[model samples]
Target: MAEEDAASKRRRLGQEVPSGGGVGEDGGDPDLIGRLPDEVLGSIITLLPTTDGARTQILSRRWRPLWRAAPLNLEADFGSLTLLESERVASQLCKLLSAHEAPVRRFSLKCNGRYGLSQPIAPLLQSHRLQDIQEFELYVRGDLPPSLLSLSPAALRVLHICSRPESPLWTTSTLSFPSLRELTLVDVDVSESALHGVLSRCPVLETLLLDNIRARRVRINSLTLRSVGVSDCGYPWEARLEELMIVDAPLLERLIPRVPSHHLVIRVIHAPRLRTLGYLHDDIPRLQLGTMHFEKMVLVRPSDGMRSVKILGLLSAPNLDFVTGLLKCFPCVEKLHIVSYTQMIFKNDVKCYAPLECLDRHLKKVQIINYEEKRADVNFIKFFVLNARVLESMKFVVCRDKCGAKWIARQHKKLQVNGRASQRAKFDFEADCSRGPSSMVDMKHIHDLAMDPFDRSSCRCHGDALH
Candidate 1:
């Protein structure tokens, strides 16, 4: 019964199912999926899990050969494989690859301890057909086969290597990925010289990401690289040896280090067309952006000597002092996005370290996310209401989990009575309401307020847009 239902669902989805297995309401060959072209069938197999992809062969004799022609995307996570199981699985995988007529497009090998370095890994590495692979990932706790690093395909584009915590990644001084575009490394140590050596070889590299990896100095000199992110980097933001330096990358667009202002000391040695940057801390090493004038976002921090940035996003607003100090850093910020969550609220009245010049003059758009009826949240919005003379549109996104529809209505009323500085200013309230806009507010939303008119694209990201 369940089989017939599944066949019907597939038929509705425009997929041909086997007929003799079960008759359709019209009674004929219930067009079998095998009738589809090999390319289309291969695509369908790709969408299934690796196990399910193999299982399709059992559906019928015609389906048996379909899995063999599909591009192989095999991931062997032998972390939990017992010694015997490891040997068996590795043997089977190698045997499967040996007979595979189709190209192996993606392969990932991860081990809990000793599985990656075992003899079985060697056979797979020497398969020679590896030259056809495009995406290769390795996460191992112990030493990797020497052939693995040098075994990458000339056509490989994505390479992610997470090495053991104690040992540095030991690629030969001659090692490089000629066709590599995106590289992600975690918990691997690489000396500055080796790091530069590997990077110099990849001319078309686009994105370089590092997580908890130790490299005293990382110099990106690629012409094609567009985005780079380093999070929870090896050294603390204050370490003398810790420095993130980018030099002569003309197409560099996004340089994002998820580490907080209190955590990174970034120096753009030189990037000509750089677009977005973030997490500029107060304690960063003396930095320079070599006349590459591109609008970038700055995370707010107290007394940061940061300059030449425009946007500011935050998750926590400890006090108005933090806000005041932030405005002082970027005096002419053209755009902003903020949220009214309770953790952002301060316990007492706050003082500004210096006069805030942006909100009084140049500040334009502001978004408040997770807004609630709590007084602390309202006060945060109220601060912007009375100030921000040139403000264009202020958006408040209220969540049902935080407050009910009734409380959100009252909060909007409170803001309108507070009086905004700009005659052209508008406040938009985006919330999940019950009925019509009238169910929330028809006349008020139109004549006075523009409820839920948020154009998300104008912002960098919806939730963590700036932060």
Candidate 2:
């Protein structure tokens, strides 16, 4: 009896006591993982990627029932996948989900199935098993039956749906998804009022992303909202809304927006926490980021004029007046970045240029790309070095051939003697010019625009991020 008691102690804590006795006569060692409680083991299994997690069932009898203990965290990628393979994967998910006894925690189905076999899975979307779903992402080609996504939205935390232009999710009524935190939508057409209703409903929403969306106008109002991104999101010339307004959001930190046509005006007011702003690589008329305490901001050289910008980014600094006028807005910007360095032929030389007072105390970093070794361009850079008291690093990027040894040596000596206000400042070497879509880091925020935001012409950056 004492020997049997000792053997029992060696068995896994959660393992069922064997009816034959303490030890399986052929045993080598007890399963270490079996010692953990069932719920704890379930959680460990949940952390694995979809396939590896599901494959664990074959390991032993204990894990066979564990897969069904928690609804599968199944994610199927079908975007570039072949139609037959994608359909097979989708079919399996549908079958597994329908037969699942437990609730699904997360489900992601993505693809543009060319074979049109996507409709058979519509019944799975309406399953009651999704009641416990915490995250749901669906990026498919055609219209999703409205009944398919009729979940209460209360349990949802992350919702990303990119549907067809013809049939979008109903934003006409107040969408009650108070628990939703991140929402991404593409190609959803809705009226301005309906869009407003959706925002008003999601009480705790933090991130909102829209791509190729249709709306007469969008007016945002949220106390808990943090970030908003819009690219190619309005109607054409004669039909666009008068303005896209952000009425009030206290927690908003980063805003990168783009509009389809040049006629729409984007406005922001009462949003105090806004820190990052830009990606004006389009023909939108104007953008107002708010009135008070605007600092540490990323900016674009106002196509309209100088009074509109804080930290100026230029395709071309047409004249000295535009530069000075821009500095006058936020004279102490810490970092200044220039993307295109082509000299613009000024209409006329102006005598009025304001001195920048904020440079000596605040500006520290500056990066210039597509830099042409023009005399005036050198002078513009020299002014910043001479005036920036706290200046730390200055960088330049040009075409592969432009930064020859002689050219770099010439500019190095020239700027050194030009007299830097900060003694410790250093210059970084020029980077290679990358015209390829992959190298455009600054353009990352509004990447969808490069893919032809107005139409379905394929944006490479769509699947990755809104950085």
* Worst window of 10 by summed lDDT in candidate 1: 440-449
Measured over all alpha carbons after superposition, the RMSD of each candidate to the real structure, in angstroms, is 10.0, 9.0
lDDT of 1 by residue, 1-467 (tens): 75677677878999766433344335555444545677788888865656778888897776778898887877888778777787788789888888977788888888765554456677777787788888888888876666665685788888888876445565346776889988877667777787788888887888787666666667677778877766544344422235567877777755555433234456676665554444333334343566322122234323443344455544444345555655665576656655333444464342223335787888888766566666666666677776778888787665643444666567757765346777687766665322111111111111111122123433333432210
lDDT of 1: 0.62
* Candidate 1 clash pair list: 16-33, 339-369
TM-score of each predicted structure versus truth:
0.69, 0.69
**lDDT of candidate 2 vs native?**
0.60
Q: By TM-score, how accurate is candidate 2?
A: 0.69
**Per-residue lDDT of model 2, residues 300-347, tens digit only:** 444332232233343334244555555565554565655553446444
Candidate with the greatest lDDT versus the true structure = 1
